[model samples]
Target chain A: MLAKPGLLVLGLALGLSTLLPSEAEAHRRWLLPSSTVLAGESDLVTVDAAASNGLFLFDHRPMALDSLVITGPDGAPVDPTILGAGAYRSMFDVPLRAQGTYRIALVSDGVMGSYELNGERHRFRGSGDALPAGATNISSSRSNSRTETFVTLGAPTDTALQPTGSGLEMIPVTHPNDIVAGEPAVMCFLLDGQPAADLEVEFVAGGTRYRDEPGIVMLRTDAEGRVTLQPSEAGMYYLEVSSSQDAANGQPGRRASYTAVLEFLPL
Target chain B: MRVSIAFAFAATGLAAAPSAAQEMAISVEIPRLKVAEYHRPYVAVWIEDAAGKSVRTLDVWYDVDLKPEDGAKWLPDMRTWWRRAGRSMTMPANGVTAPTKAPGTHSRTYRQGSRPLANLPAGSYNLQVEAAREVGGRELVTVPFQWPPKALTSASARGKSELGAVRLTTKR
Candidate 1:
């Protein structure tokens, strides 16, 4: 019953998400919490987020948060103010007042692209125009990234740690807020509440500013839709799962893309 | 206040538990694949508590059938279980660890009040199965189940590439 509050806020937040402006295709957004595991109730936690076109490089502009929903230990919404912003990232801090898990969800609007197929530029977007002889094709619209992270203070509880029931979702088998370094963290990906099988998940070591493309460990879920990753060190870890499907109508090359980013630390 | 309240609810749920004289079985299948290079997947199956601590290891299928038995060297590739319990275990571990399984359904059944089900307290647990191949992909699947069946507890999950369907059935 406690998960209802977070789910309620999430439902409202997702309903509002559709009206926002779409971001660029290459811009992958991520939310990074300052401390994944807080020691006590009075402790404060900060989160820095950005949309990056380059891999693991925070060089792109920070995304405007149309709806920033922070569900706290009791499943009530916790609002956070934008403390600062740079060209590539924005920062916010919140005081931890409860003893359970905290969930930060950022849902942006879907992006639409209509490019004229000049040569070999045929991609997902198409405008239902008749294809000329040896002409380039068009692409339709694509969904923006939905980013989320879990932060725990003092103890772990079943707050918003489960799947959010829409788009790209990560349901933790072993609770994400209570993970330990060197221990295997298990989770499953669900696309619209159903098990997403053979989904490719990219796990990257975090905390690097922007020098090199971080080493990526590629993993695919089993038939039952699960992937396991053991955190090597105690720093930041990024788990990204994304999928794209061709338009069911099978015409102007419409494609729907879904991405979910989860940032946490192994304690 | 919230933590204690939640803990009390969990304890009360466990206290109203059923007897543990039921039969349980785990069915794990390794899917056959066609690739340029194929090797038998080294699988590790274990149970963990809600806190993610390994409670018992059901089976570890490595290179037991090989001549040199050097297959144990690659068990670390099943990184999740190796970090949790495999490192503490000795090689040629009898009764629990076996050889690489072929591409088929393998069922492991423990009788009532066995070493695993007997020691498991009435609580929430996750049965995790991980498989890693030499040149292929690595996959893990978890089946969440509650001990002392809330009602004939049965859960199943499917993997895509390396593993088939994983099912855990408990009969009261």
Candidate 2:
């Protein structure tokens, strides 16, 4: 069983967030893998699904894995194991398998709790990780359409890094070419995509959240979605994105949320 | 490898320091005296477009004399700037300690000095101000200002006693 890593996010944020927040949740549902894990170096593909909560709703419960459904390259359902908690696992260590996309979805009818998402949904992944001979491209996050944010996948040869205008966010790949070895750095955010306006973006890097860095650091997007960040020290970094303004009307809880890509690119 | 890593950090940090040479400032004042029974304004100042769209976040000043629990409870009211820039940040004050200004004069300064603010494009934006006094009231006052990062004269606007006359000065 592959270990599910992000089950603790919501719990950790309880202290500062507003309970019974008036605003509906506008969160990135499933943080997809920006690109398929390289067959040469990586093997297993694990996923964690999160349910949405509308504004002012305070329902924080783990999604029970009552039925885990995964469709392989053949439009056939694959079996996954419920690891006792709010997590699920599947192994892709098969031989030179098929070259197609797979989807891993769940149906829990999510307990009738407090908050609801921007709409009705049970988490779904239209594509799974890739096999060496082929590839499976899935966005690292869903573009919470209600909030107008989009998610994109990355490729080894990606060149949109010079901060291309992609809608409400400008994705700047902060890691340079060769993928920064242990620190591959292509990040996603829900900004205006264009760089003409100074945006307030937040994320964690080298285990450190970059909400307030001194002065500022400039990351220029190259032809590819690749930008380089020479960390002042060798450490883990996470770039968390959120709204830079208050959702005016009735929505109360969420201030903002952006796409965060956890790439272990070592210098 | 470690030495190589050290050199890279040193290089980027040095590079991160933008060439310093521009500045921006604000001087907030209320014209007359309006003595409310007892309450100071929780003020938030930022820049936006004529269409009432927000552009740059300037500052948010709340009660520094609030208890830890009380502060946390009421802090979310500074919604505009918080959403655009504050949520991801941890406030330095555990309790409200900064002195609360009366219905008189107020001012603060911010400088890009020369580190060109990344997202502010060349155009027009409104220098806006909003205030919410505890057990008091809420009012939004705005003053428009143009941009290009060059030295500019003071921009001004006025309102009820809550927010008297607000002025902004920018030097690039």
Candidate 3:
């Protein structure tokens, strides 16, 4: 009977962590960094100042790229070429050195920001395309030198299944954590209601800039599409989910979209 | 029918929740509900719980047929409401199936018993509303609300210009 009690305690512990997953993640925010894109090794990437301001979607209002900086992998400054009226672009040729992961951080000294990228270091989904539920932007005070951005890449979330198969799934949603400290909470995205594997996803946070660098967090989803993190702090958190891998290509954009649910608890 | 049914979605951060709590209840209404945006104002209301943190978009009254696909877009605003109720249910039968609300009094009730409030046992919560108009601005008002079946039976807050007075009452 005593052994059973201990077993019960062990079972309770297991249920708590798995059921709640990670206690509410603190709010995460980052400023969009101006990183230079390399040509060749054509894997598309999308950059945004923040995910929450909704300006990243351009539905709120078009962001002025002129108010931003640009960089390239060759460690040189790059110019913003007018793609459409307000849209701008610079091609990336230098590939991420190896299969190893790197991150593209967005940096801006002013205002809060949120952003995300998918790769091995922070893979949150199951395929090359990720339906990221949320992202985080970090604040930074860097140089104003106009040049090509030098960014390390995070492990991108890879989309493994064709939505045409068992079909695209719905992302999870939760409440808003009004009290926590972070602005952009990394909302977790799970396919089939669990952490998935090997998918490309993106993250967007408050309008703060990461200066084209990935911050301290590098979370990866398990086979169930879940990203559980043990935070060093406690606060409000939100995640935005997007499945559109081609968002970097400016195509239909990321698919399987869901807003991150708010999580508030102690670290 | 390609008419535009304009609406708004917004949130309010009412209060902070305690560390170990369980569940939240949401009730919503609008004294300004009506048919047209310029007229009185059709309103949408809902509950957003923990399991489904997105607005459990409980109720909405606007011209669903205004456009073939108008009502679908506004679903994202009630972040908490959408996840619990809106995301899973079909639009026609969900809380927001109605076409518009009258201008008198309207109210709805919800509970977060048994289930984790969006996976959290208990904590603080906020009530948010977005009031949008055709030629007017959309206003989102939030008031803080707490949890754990407290001694407080009723709470109230004033809505933005688009809405009249707002009040909440709990029952046994």
Please provide TM-scores computed only on chain A for all of the candidate models, following their numbering: 0.72, 0.35, 0.26
Using lDDT, give the best candidate's number: 1
Task: Give lDDT tens digits, candidate 2, residues B91-154.
Answer: 4332212445766777776544212143355678787777666676566787777765566678
A145-262: candidate 2 lDDT, tens digit per residue: 1111111111122232332233234344442212334444454443444332343444334321343443234454444333444444433233333343432353321232333333
Stretches of candidate 3 off by over 4 Å are A1-182, A185-267, B1-42, B48-56, B77-89, B94-96, B109-128, B141-152
Question: lDDT score, residue B137, model 2?
Answer: 59
Model 3: DockQ vs. true structure? 0.01
C-alpha DockQ for predicted model 2: 0.01
Those runs of model 2 whose alpha carbons end farther than 4 Å from true positions after fitting are A1-267, B1-19, B30-36, B49-55, B82-89, B92-99, B113-121, B149-151
Expressed as tens digits, the lDDT of each residue in A225-261 for candidate 3 is 6443333344322343333232333232223333322
Measured against the true structure, the TM-scores of the candidates, in listed sequence, are 0.48, 0.33, 0.32
Q: What is the Cα-based TM-score of model 1?
A: 0.48
lDDT of each: 0.67, 0.41, 0.35
Model 3: per-residue Cα lDDT over B1-172, one tens digit each: 1011011101122123322222333444455444454543445554334432543354555556655435544442333333234445555554346766655556654533311222233445555555545555455555555554464466666775766655555432
Which of the two, 1 or 2, has more lDDT? Answer: 1
Query: What DockQ class does candidate 3 belong to?
Result: incorrect
On the 0 to 100 scale, the lDDT of residue B72 in model 1 is: 58
